[model samples]
Target: MGERAYNFGAGPAMMPDAVIERVAREWQDFRGEGYSAMELGHRSEHFADILARAKADLRALLDVPESHHILFLHGGATPHFAMVPLNLAQPGESADYIHTGYWSDKAMAEASALVNVRIAASAADSEFDRVPDRAGWQLDPAAAYVHICSNETIGGVEYDGDPDTGNVPLVADMSSNILSRPIDVARYGLIYAGAQKNIGPAGLAIVIVRDDLLERVRAGVPSVMKYARHVEWDSMYNTPAAFAIWVAGLVFEHVRKAGGVTEMARISVEKAQKIYAAIDASSLYINRIQPASRSRMNVPFFLREPRLEQRFLDGARRRGLLNLKGHRATGGMRASLYNAMPLAGAQALADYMTEFERKNG
Candidate 1:
């Protein structure tokens, strides 16, 4: 276990070691039950207890209000791109979107196919290195909702705080950064995230939607896609991702035992600061995003000599730092500082970067 390399991939990223160990121990039989969690019937009392506990732990960790319903749904955040407009926005009604980076653009493209999409603000002009100011957002007062990708994994941009949308409900795709910090759940009408980065695994998505917004589902929308149906059925309208939910449940408990989101946020900031300081001091590496908009979760940096990228990756891997390569579309490297990544891991990467620059610069 100690020999494992530090993982920094964008999604399906690192999880708490405690959570992994617990899963491994219970993989064959959960809590001495006759069957594995995956094999247990979803309707069985045992599995129902698991589901209830997971939801409760998550709610406590996030301090979710009773007014919001937490649904452990099947599809990842991508599917919600269509489901959002399908359930919330009418065919002709527009939904305002703030396009920050790759994921946000994909979200808008998917929503556009279902309903009218208004680009309220975009940072494409800056190659997605920054988030546009809230003051410049051109929101439609009549739009059903205002959507934003709270954190951009590929572009390394993040909103420092929630954007004010007045009466329009705020819907955020918080896939990469959810649970990494303390967020005000009340400020968002809906917050959806794939349980890969900071949650648990890849097959599940956690959706926190305000109860009142569930009444807006468009006619003819599939029962499975409707948030109301999920809430009514307790996220079990169909067979849920039992194994993933079990693991996420363990993670939620782990977070709570480890001092919750406030502690997670403190460590996340420290990790990002350590790595970003190294990048700032080195002439060989450069982070393109402006300081204000830079993401504390994903730090995308570039090598001064593009040809040295492979060498850098190789060196980092040999040094037990893994997945430091950036997204292919943008090139260079990215270090995703998720909640499960310890401060020691970030410091190790920072140290490696400094030594690499000294040897290669």
Candidate 2:
């Protein structure tokens, strides 16, 4: 196999080389079945086993309580933006959302169309560089659920810890940082993540809904959008994303074998630190987000001289540093240091930044 560049693209992002190799090895003949994994039958026993193993590995790894059901939804985390309000709250009922960054704002924007979305707390006043302090949150006790994006992929801001939303169901869109650390599943009312970030491939979202919330589905909600129905159908409400789920299963197993989330967290912190250190130490580079709120997964920084942005990116590409461009919504440079990125990848990025700064600063 020839060398592969480190993929820092946010979604459809870098996957563990081992998982990619395993997929390649099995793509044509899944376990000697002689059928391509893409051709896998969702209802077949083979897929059942694959799904069960993925769920089990994820459950065991995260210690998801018996009170929750893990769902492998077809759309990436987006559909849940609408499905969540529809399933969790009655039409026109209010739900509290903490506006943190681009994705969180998107969630609020989507939910506002379906429900009375209340901004319990927001950092927009600060330009979305950090999470609104939890102390200032004015939560609605009667709201259906309190939603937060544990890690904002675009703005590169992340929560330092699980928030205490007393008595309210805390729902989080952990799309960018789900498996990067261990979470107390019991603390959340529901947790959903699109697979493009820390999990497997894109187009799949994981939903861990507390069992009791199943009965609360507002009447008239479509069967497909209803959580209870999906739970009863065992994530088979519609034709599942078989290939993505299968690949996700392999990724889950790979994560488990690599010492699970604790180890992933350890490595993630170090990798992020390596890159952030480079930015903080340089005068020409800048990360405006507060230190405590900086993300451990996506690190976005800007060059002091915007004119050199393209030149820096071009140089980075020539060095095999791919996808360092920031989200189009926020113009700058972003390096998504997901679990698949090796320590060497982070070091290489830091080294390149240093060399670039020394030459251009």
Candidate 3:
């Protein structure tokens, strides 16, 4: 096996070396069962224990309260965009949506088809360069719930504080940046994240929902769309994504042993700061997002001389830094420094940036 480069892909991104190595060894046999974790039956006792431990570890890491239920769902956070409105919003009833960036807007579009969606706040006017001030929000008194993308993976904006929605409960799609920091579960009615980013792999989404919100689903929605159904069945209403769930469980255990969310938050800040500081110090690079709202998980920056972009990217790859490529839609460069990206990797990128500028600037 080759040395893993400093991977900065946005999703299905880097995972801890230890987790990868351990999983590599266990892929041959798990817990003396003489079969890989992937081959194990989801309904078997071995997998069941693994599933339970994953849930417990995630709960402990997030400090999820007993009043909330966590589910390992099959679809990515994309499906939850529709499911959230289906379960939470009755037909003709409105829901408040904060439009911050691409994902948030996509979610609002899905919800708008099902229910009246009020634009409580939007960063559209600023070209999505900054998160809208909380004081600028115009929440609807009669809305089913207020929704926000706690972090925008594309635009790289993030919320600095808990959103205040008054009587209306908050629903958040924390897909890209979930578990990169500590979150107070009590602050939101529902928080869902696709497993591809900070969690495990694709095909599994972790939904943390308050029990009360689960009970408030109006009838006539699809049974599968109901959060209550999953809660009642322990997220196994039908056959689950067994492999993804098992891997997600291992990731949960890994995060817990590494000292939970608080430590993760600290490491995340340190890692982000290293890159952001480098960007800030360099005349050759610039991060457009407002400093206060800049994402600690994804750092998007641009070269002062746009013409040298290819040279920069090609050189990065040649230097053993992979996937530092920016999203085509929003071109330049985006280094997604998720939890699994170590401090050394960030420093390596910083060093690369400095040397690249010294030569190219």
In order of lDDT, best first, we have 2, 1, 3
> Candidate 2 lDDT, tens digit per residue, 187-284?
99999999998898889999999999888788888898888998999999899999999999988999999999999999999999999999999999
lDDT of each: 0.91, 0.92, 0.88
Q: List the residue pairs that clash in candidate 1.
A: 326-333
TM-score of each: 0.98, 0.98, 0.97
Candidate 3, residues 1-361: lDDT per residue as tens digits?
7877999899888988888887898888877789986787878997788789988988898889998888999888989999998888778899999999899999999888998999999999998988789999999888999999999998889997678787898999999888888888898889999999899888789999988787677778777888999988887888888888878887888888888778888998898999998898899998989899999888989998999999999999998888887888889899998889989999999899989999999
The most accurate candidate by TM-score is 2
| Candidate maximizing lDDT | 2
* Global Cα lDDT for candidate 3: 0.88
> Which residue pairs come into collision in candidate 3?
none
Tens-digit lDDT track of model 1 for 1-361: 5787799998889888888888878778877986675676787887788899999999999899999999999978888999999888888999999999899999999999888999999998988889999999999999999999999999899988877798899999999888878888899999999999999879799999999999899899989999999999999999998888888898999999999999998998899999999999999999989999989999999999999999999999998899988898888899999999999999999999999999999
Residue 131's lDDT within candidate 3 is 79
